[model samples]
Target: MTGTDTDSGRPLPRRLLAHVGVAALVYLGVCAVLLVWALVVTARETTDASMAGVIPFLATAPASLAFLMLPANSVVFFTAIAVGAAVNAAIISWCTRALRRGGHPDR
Candidate 1:
């Protein structure tokens, strides 16, 4: 997917979005595997200090915040996650394109 088309010439964004949607599934699959690995590791480990800190933070921070501010933070977190996913998708797409163009047979 170069920015332009070979024949019918549809806008790149439409094509890119479709490609990204499919690619996102591959990304999600890898994430699911990692999540399962993390769960297995957590279950096997007797103690994890970083994980221990999360409960106190989640419990205390929300109670300390104003009710109105809580929703704003939730929106910000969701936006951040979306932005991060888009950036990751872009990087993956770029790398895939680059490798293909560079004639790396692995792809």
Candidate 2:
């Protein structure tokens, strides 16, 4: 019945930005889960129990992100970033659509 799909009564661009923000939060949650699992596995296997173990686990996620070190090649590094952005955009689009459909059940 309304021109805008958002129940918050904001413009489309703002809604899109909110959708992207939510998607980013989801992305960080996934990364945090990966980081926690890595740390837990490291914790279980080690007998020495030194501070050095904690440092590497904490640094890895940011280091890989900053250096684009995955796949270990220049071309692959750029490709990975592109792929990641595309995936995040897809997630935002999906979330926006879900919000549109769910928020206006009368339609």
Candidate 3:
């Protein structure tokens, strides 16, 4: 039996929501890792006099691009992050819904 067969008893919206939660967690995990990496790099470069501190800023680019493009405030930063999470969740829901609808080929 295929994965879709197993989803027969469950509602699609519930499945989609579950997928959204999973996608949010995965997205947050990636952001958390990058944030930690940036912090570590910043700490290691503290004694240097180069422009390496920019690395942390670059690392957060994906999560904060909205804020960077805007007024660059805490509100904007949080908004960007929230928007990112929502977008990620929506994309995941769409893809998983398609998959559950048997949008795959079998050999």
lDDT of 1 by residue, 1-107 (tens): 46354533667765555566556557645544544454465577756633642332233233223333445454653343344444566667777667656866554
Q: Which candidate achieves the best TM-score against the true structure?
A: 3
Between 1 and 3, whose TM-score is larger?
Answer: 3
RMSD of 1: 10.7
lDDT of 3: 0.57
Residue-level lDDT of model 2, residues 8-95, one tens digit each, is: 7777767756656666555645655644555576577766444433333343333335545455664654344445544555666677
TM-score against truth, every candidate:
0.39, 0.33, 0.45
- lDDT for residue 78 in candidate 2, whole number 0-100: 39
The C-alpha local distance difference test score for the whole of candidate 2 amounts to 0.54
State how far residue 37 of model 2 sits from its true place (Å): 30
lDDT of each: 0.49, 0.54, 0.57
Q: Once superposed on the true structure, which residue ranges of model 2 sit more than 4 Å away at CA?
A: 1-70, 103-107
Q: Name the runs in model 3 displaced over 4 angstroms.
A: 1-24, 39-64, 103-107
The 10 consecutive residues of candidate 2 with the worst lDDT sum are: 52-61
